[model samples]
Target: MGGQISVRGVTHVYTNRYTRETVLALEDISFEVEQGEFVCIIGPSGCGKSTLLYLIAGLMRPSMGEILVDGRPVTGPGPDRGMVFQEFAILPWRTVWRNISHGLEIQGVPKEKRDEIVRHYIRLIGLEGFENKYPYELSGGMKQRVALARTLACNPKVVLMDEPFAALDVQTRITLRTELLKISLQLSNTILFVTHSVDEAALLGDRVIVLTRRPGRVKEIVRNPIPRAARDEHTMENPAFIEYRNHLFYSVRSEVQVAEHEALVRG
Candidate 1:
């Protein structure tokens, strides 16, 4: 069976010892991600977008509310949720093959089985002959490909990405973004991507969710028409592209002011 995610009214708050203050990271945030849906989250910096991702992944618990996957409550990190962080979280010491197979190794999959999946995804991510290369040997884009390949190798139910393409140069980021759409669709896994780019959200997400600032709350959920239409290069620069981008732009802009006001009160 495929996977679906449902995040109930979730809120996250942090207590600061030094300041003797309670910081609200996410407040009354609620949204649901259907099976095989590619959803992107965008907002101002420190608006708790990443906090929502961590809560959904069960890396940490929400101060309140519940997160569920396939009708089960998430209490801890599991194979069902795969994460790709921005800093190319791959280990430097391990060779490409070892890093990709790390998750399967943890679950004690047989050598033959693990090797087969690794080999398949190596080619899937276009890392065909770079098996023994170290992370230091790869370029920024290539390293991120390895990160994606490693996450996909585990066969997770959904992938959570936090600005996976944020660090690359202009040309590399664009090329990888185009390729990531292909890789994501071919793998057929549910994805929740977090980013600050309106263009990226419009291009990649079937629906884009915007959040308010710290103590983040869901502001709007917009369905991107292009991905639902004929998928092509020209579709992104189409007339609707500007319209969709503006919808998110204005939505996020309003939230940015809200976030700033909250920040001032807290400070």
Candidate 2:
């Protein structure tokens, strides 16, 4: 089952060890992601998008407030949450099959069950023929598919993706977005995806949360008017898609300008 996530009055402060310089990364960020929902977060470069994702993943803790997954406080990384980073992050030494099965092995899933799960995800991500190939032998997009399959094979309640497709070329990124939509629909996985692309957010998110520049705060949450089943490449050409894209672009652009001005003043 997919997990519901609640971020309550969260705030984070980062302190540089060497300089002792502290920066407020996120403040009073409160939001709830419904079970099985695909939510996207977008903000300026310095805005705490990835920071918030890490907090939810239990890789880091907030200075204030709390994050809960399914009414349980997230104290640290656990099996219930899976993370796919921008980097391929798959083990070089392991072939595609081995990489996808690694997490199940750690969880002590029997070899037979692990094999079943690994093969399922391999097909789900369309890497059926490449299962024996190592990461170095795969293309960038193929490697990312392996990374994603590795995360999905474990059946985590929540999937946290931090720009999982940012490194791919335009065509590959587009293709993966569609594949991701399909996977999410088939598995009903609750996902929190962070990306800088307004178009991506508009295309994939049921709701898009926009954040301000520094000390990122929830500026707005826009719901996509386009139905999930209808969001395909052709959907981008629809009037509603264009309108949503334009709205998000303007929202993010405004924050980008403010962040740039702040940087100039600091300089």
Candidate 3:
């Protein structure tokens, strides 16, 4: 079964306790992610990229409208919708292998079966040698890999990522992006990635969804014409990649300017 997501006229609002004010985070947000499609969301800071992810993940609900996965309303967080955050949420005390097995253990998968599944993903994420290492002993990328492996180990239908690679160095981010692309294709999991980097969005997303500054709303949803099979080093050098990157860059830059202008006006 493929993972398909539908968001209909979603509007989310929050209250500021200190200021005793209401904040409109997302406004009239509407989009649909097809089964097995990879979609990236990018926008200016405070544009509610993460907020949208949270809504879709059912970590919280929109003050209005609804989010559906596989035609069913998303009422709460479930194993079908897994999330990987910027911070490596892996347990520091556990070894990489144990960390990956944590979810399976919770589900009461037998030790032997859980270990088998964990070993496969450890190898899949290139943590074979470091399986015995704890989070502190691993680099940022490796720690993130453990987190990824753990999430994938649960076999989630739709993976929601909130800047999972933002903290990594440039080289590490690039390498992991490639690895993640490969893994996603192999697994055919639907992904909704929230990112600030235009290049990253263009490179990984089948379609890039851009939002306006604050009170985020979909500004544009640009389909990547570049075929996934062609998105290699050669493709990066190709004109199409540069063109798409520039396209998204400009789209986001305009919103960023508007945000800055509003900030200046407030000041």
Candidate 2 per-residue C-alpha lDDT over 48-155 given as tens digits, one digit per residue, 9 for 90 to 100:
999999999999989999999999999999999999999988999999999999999999999999998898999899998898899999999999999999998989
Better of 2 and 3 by lDDT: 2
> How many clashes in candidate 2?
0
By lDDT: ranked, best first? 2, 3, 1
Off by over 4 Å in 2: 265-267
Worst ten in a row by lDDT for model 2: 180-189
TM-score for each of the candidates: 0.93, 0.97, 0.97
**lDDT, residue 26, candidate 2:** 99
Better of 1 and 2 by TM-score: 2
Order of models, best TM-score first: 2, 3, 1
Scored by lDDT, model 3 comes in at 0.92
The lowest-lDDT stretch of 10 consecutive residues in candidate 3 is 227-236
Per-residue CA lDDT of model 1 for 1-267, tens digit only, reads: 466998888989988889979889998888888988999999988889898999888889999999999999999999899999999989899999999999989989999999999999999889889999999999999999999989999989989999999999989988888788777767668999999988788888999999876768888899987764355456667888878888898888887877678779999
Error of 2 at 95 (Å): 0.6
How do the residues 48-156 of candidate 3 rate in per-residue lDDT, one tens digit apiece? 9999999999989899999999999999999999999999989999999899999999999999999899989988998888888999999999999999999999989
Every candidate's lDDT: 0.88, 0.93, 0.92
